[model samples]
Target: MLITRRFFPYFVTQCLGALNDNIYKNVLLLLVTYSQVNELPISVNMFVNLAAGVFILPFFLFSAHAGMVADNVDKAMLIRRLKLIEFIIMSCAAVAILSQSYLVMLLLLFLMGTQSAYFGPVKYSLLPQTLKENELVTGNAWVEMGTFISILVGTLSAGLIVASDNSLVAASATVVTLAAIGYLSSRAIPALPPQGKIEKIRFTPLSGTWRSIAKVRQTPSIWMAILAISWFWFLGATYLTQFPNFAKLHLHADATVVSLLLALFSIGIAVGSWICERVSYGHVELGVIPFGVLGLTVFGVDLIFAIPPAPVDLSTVYSFSTFIAASQHYRVMADLFMVGLSGGLFIVPLYAFIQSRAEKGECAQAIAANNIVNAFFMVTAAVLSIVLLGLLEWSIPQLFLLLAALNTVVALYVYSQVPEFAQRFVSYILSHVMYRVNVTGREHIPAQGAGVIVCNHVSYVDALIIMGSSTRPMRFVMDKSISEIPLLKYLFRHAGVIPICSPKQCEKTYEQAFEHIHQALNNEELVCIFPEGRLSADGDIAEFRPGIERILAADPVSVTPMALKGLWGSYFSHKGGHALTTRPKRFWSRVEVNIGETVNGVELGRHGLHQQVSELFERKS
Candidate 1:
C-alpha cells in the first residue's frame, strides 16, 4: 500500500540494476568455469576469484565518495546519471564479450562495480526521502524482496544462457537491455531535494571512510542497528559460501541439488522479508529481530546435526530430486530455508530504523558507513570459514555449528549495546504474535521531547503493549519486583526502565528511581510509571501511589494518561493466583490502549491523574 508513484519506479530501477549486475557477474563466472579454451596463464579457479574481487572492490574504494555525492546532489538526477554510467559500462562489457577478451571484460566488471558503489548509498538513503515514517518498513521490505528475487532470476537466467552456443552474445544483449531499462526507470523517479549543503568532496578513501563511520557513530541507535545488519550479512556470507561444499561433500549431491538449496534459501528470505512487513502492520516493529535470530540459530544448529555421515561412494552424485527424496536431506534444506528466512526478519527493520533515525543530511553517509562495515563482516566471514574448514580441517557441518554459536554471542552483544532492539523484539512478539493491539490517540504521545505516561498496570506485559503501541522509546518506572523477573530483567535493564520500591521496603531503590526519572526527563525522554505501585488483584483500578507526584515535582513535564483494555484476565495478570502460575486463557485476544490528551503535570494532582486514567479505562471497557 505504501508503494506510491516515486517508490514504484525507484523500486523497479533498483531491482533491475541488481538483476543486471548479477547477470553479468554470473555469466562471466560461467565463462571462466566451463570454457575449455586454455587462453590465459591463470587457472580457472584463480580467474573466477579475480572476477569476484574486481566486482566488489569498488564498494571498498568508492563507497564514501558515493555517499557524499548522493547527499550533495538531487537524488533523481544522480540516479539517472548512474544509470547512464551503468549503460555505458554494460555496452563496453557487451563489446568485450563479442571480442572474447577476458581482460577487457574484467575491467568492465570493475567499472560495473564502481557504478554499483555509487548507487549503494543513494538506493538506501532515497527511501527516507521518498517515503513517510510509517512506510519505511514496507518500502525496505519491497526493496529486499525485489533484490533477492532478482538475484534468483539473474543467476538462473545467466546459467541458462551460458549453456547456449552464443553465450557471450546472449549475456551481452541481456545486460545491455537491462541497463537501458534501468535508465528508463530512473527517468521516472521523482526529484528529491538535497537534504543539506554537500560539503567539499573528499576522494581519499581512508579519511572519507573514517568520516562517514564517525558520522554514523554519532547516533548510537543507528550505529547499533548497522552492526546488527552487518552481522546478518556475516552469517549470510558464511552460510551461502558453504552451501556448495555442504551439498557436495556432506550430502553427496550434484550441482542441481546445490542450486536447489541456494534457491530455497533465496525464496525463504524473500518470503520472510514480505512477511516481516505484513506482521509488523505498518510499524517499524523491531520486536521480531530476536525471534528471527533465534530461528536462525536453532535452524543453523539443527542443520549441523541433520547431515548424516558422508556416504562411502562419494563419487555417486545425487540429483535434486534424488537428494531430497530422503527425509534427512529434506530437513537440511528446510534448515537452510529457515536460516535465510530468519536473516530477512533480522535485517529489514534494522535497515528501516537506520533510515528513520538518521539525521537528514548524513543519512546517505550513514548508509555508506553501513556498507563498509557490512563488507568487512562478509570478508571476515569468508576468512573465518576458510580457517575453520581448510586449515583446521573442520567439516562444513562443524563450521556451521561454530558459526551458529558465534552468532549467539554477536546477537547478545548487539542487544546489550542497544536494548531498544530487545525491547522492540519483546513488544513485537506481544503485539503481533500474542495479541492484536490497537492504540487510540497515539498522536497524544509526543513524537519528540520528554513527558510522563501514566497508565494502569493491568498485566505483566502492559509495558510491552504500551511500547508496541507508541513509536517513541519510553522508560517505564516499574516495581522493583517486576523488573527482577528473570525472563524480563535483561530486557528491563537494557530498556532503561527505572525500578522502584517503597522507601520503607528499600530506601535505596526509591531514591534511585527518582534519580533515574530526573536524569531521563532531563535528557528529554518519555518515562512511563504506573502510580498504582502494583497490579490489581481484581479487575479494578488500584489506589494511585504518590510516586507520580514525586516524579513531576522533580521534573514537571506533560503527563499523558493511558489505559490497557482486554488484558485483565491474561496470563501475566493477577486474575488467577500468581501471574507466573496462571495459564493463558486466550493467546491472541484484541488488546486496546486508549491514550488520553496530554494534561499539564502541574495542573493535574494525584487525584486528577487518577480520575483521568480511570475514565480512560472505563471508556475502553
Candidate 2:
C-alpha cells in the first residue's frame, strides 16, 4: 500500500498534516507552560485549558458543514484545497511564533482546527473510495500508525526547539516546512468524484450536523459506533491535555521529559495499530473492542499506582536520561505506553466499520457526524478536567483513575446495547485465541439480499465460527436444548439465533423457529442453520436433515452451503464424550471454514446441498 499510487500520497498528506498540527500546537503549549509568561490574564492552568479548547472548538462548529461539503464534492480536490489553507495558516503561525505573540498563536490554533475540521471528512472518506474492501482495516491501521508516529516526532521536535538558544527561529521553520510538504503531497492524491447526488447551494453547520446525525441514527450499530469512537477521543483528550502538567507537577520533570513520556505513548500506539492490523487478518473485525477496553481500563488505573514518590527536593527536575535511569520511572512509562497501545486497538476497527457500513454517498456525512460528536466529547473532557483539577484540586493521577473507572461503565453500556460486539468477542476468542480459523470462499456469502447458509453441526460454537467468518451478520439456527444453556442462552437470544426442536418435543418452538427464519429471510438477512441438527457425537457428519429444504421452500433465497472441518474432538465438540465436560485436547487448534458457491434452493434440494457441503468438508480436511 505504501507504494500504491492511490494510497501512498494520501497517507503522506494526512500524516504530514498531523505532524504540522502537533508541532505548532505543542510549541505554543510548551512555551506557555515552561516560559511562565506574566502577561496571561488568567491562571496558567486556565490558559492552558483555554488554548486546548480553542483548538477543539472549531471541529465542533464546522464539522457538519465540512462533512456536507465532502459528500457533495470531489474529496481529493477538496483535500487539496484544505491543505492549501493549512499551508497559509502555518505561514502566519510562523510569524506569531517568531514574535512570541501568545494571543495571535491561540487565534492561529483555532484557524488550524477549522482546516482540520474540513480535512477530517475528506481524509477518512477517501479511504473507502481508494482502497479495496479487504484493505479497509489495514488501511485504517496504517494511517493511525502514521498519525501517531508523526505526533511523537512533532512533539519531540517542539521540545528540542524550545530548549534551543533561538527557540523562535526553530519553531518558525519546522511548522512551515511540514505544512508546505503536506500541501505538495495533497496534490498527488487521485481525484475522487462525488458519490452522492444531493445538491446543496451552501454548507450549513448546524442543520447539516442535525441531519447527518439523523442519517447516522438510521442505523443503530453505526450510531453506537460513533459514540464509542467519540468516547475514545474524549478520553484521549483528557490524558493529552494533562500530560504537560502531569509531567511537571507529578514527575518533577522538565520540558524534555514531557516530550519523552509523550513519545513513549505515541510509539506504543503506533506499534499496537500495526498489531491490530495483523490480528484482524484483512477483515474489519470488532471483536478486539472488548479486549482493547480491558487493557485501557487496566493500564490507565495502574498508572496512578506506578507513579513513584516525587523527589525529596521540590526543585529537583530530571532530564530525559535521568528520568529513565530509575526503575520506578519505568513503571510509569510502561503504564502510559500500555494505555496508548490499548487505545490503538480500540479505535481502528470502529473507523473501518463506519466507513464500510455507511452508504457510499453519505460516508463523509457519517464521518462528519463522528467528528462533531468527538469534538463535543473532547470539549467535555476539557471542562471536566477544569472542574476536577481547578475547582476540586484533584491530582492528575487521581483524574486518570476516575477516568479509568468511567471507562468500565461506558464500555459495559455499549456492549449491553450492542450484543453483536459480545458475539464478536466470543468469535474473537474462538478464532484468534482458542483456534486458528482459516476461511475460504467467503465471497460465496451474498454481499446483499437474503441468503441461507447450511453447515454440518460439528460443535456447540459452530454458529460463532460461521458468524466470525461472515462479513455480514448471521442469524444461526440452534437446538432448543443448546439455546437454553446457561450464559450461552442470553448470547443466543440477542444474536437472533433460531432454536428448533422436533415437533413431538415442543410444537411451539418448532413452529416459531421456522417462523423466525422466514421473517429473517424476508428482511434480506443472512441465516445459518446446521442441517446435521445436533452436534455430532462421533466426530462425523450426521445424515443431513430435510428441515433446510422446508425453510428454503418458504423464501427460496440463495442457499450457500459451507463446511466446518477440524472442529471435531475440540473442547466445545461432543468428541469422545459430551461437549465442554473434559479436559481440552488442544489449546490452539486449527479449524477450516470452506464456503461453497450459492445455489438456488429450488434447484438444489436438501440432498444436493448436503453433497456440496460434504465435498467441501472432505476436500478441505
- After superposition, the stretches of candidate 1 with alpha carbons farther than 4 Å from their true spots are 196-200, 308-315, 324-328, 432-436, 441-444, 479-489, 499-515, 531-559, 571-589, 596-615
Name the lDDT of candidate 1: 0.86
Candidate 2's residue-wise lDDT over 346-375, tens digit each? Answer: 999989989988887788889989998998
Residue lDDT tens for model 1, 1-621: 445677989999999999999899888888878885488778888888788778778888888999999898999999999999999989989998888888788889999989988999999999989886678899999999999899888888888999988888898899999999999989999999788876787688878888788888878989988888898888888877887888888888888887898798888899889988887777688887887889888999998888877767768788978887867677888888898898888889888888877778778888999998988888888788878888989988788898788889989998888878878877878887789888788878876689999999888888888999876789999899999999889888887789999999999989988998999999989999998999988978888988888888889899999988888888998886779787778888989899999998667788899999999998934
TM-score of each: 0.89, 0.93
Task: List pairs with backbone clashes in candidate 2.
Answer: none
Error of 1 at 207 (Å): 1.6
Residue 268 of model 1: what lDDT?
86
User: Once superposed on the true structure, which residue ranges of model 2 sit more than 4 Å away at CA?
Assistant: 29-48, 94-105, 162-170, 196-202
Best by lDDT: 2
Which candidate comes out best when scored by TM-score? Answer: 2
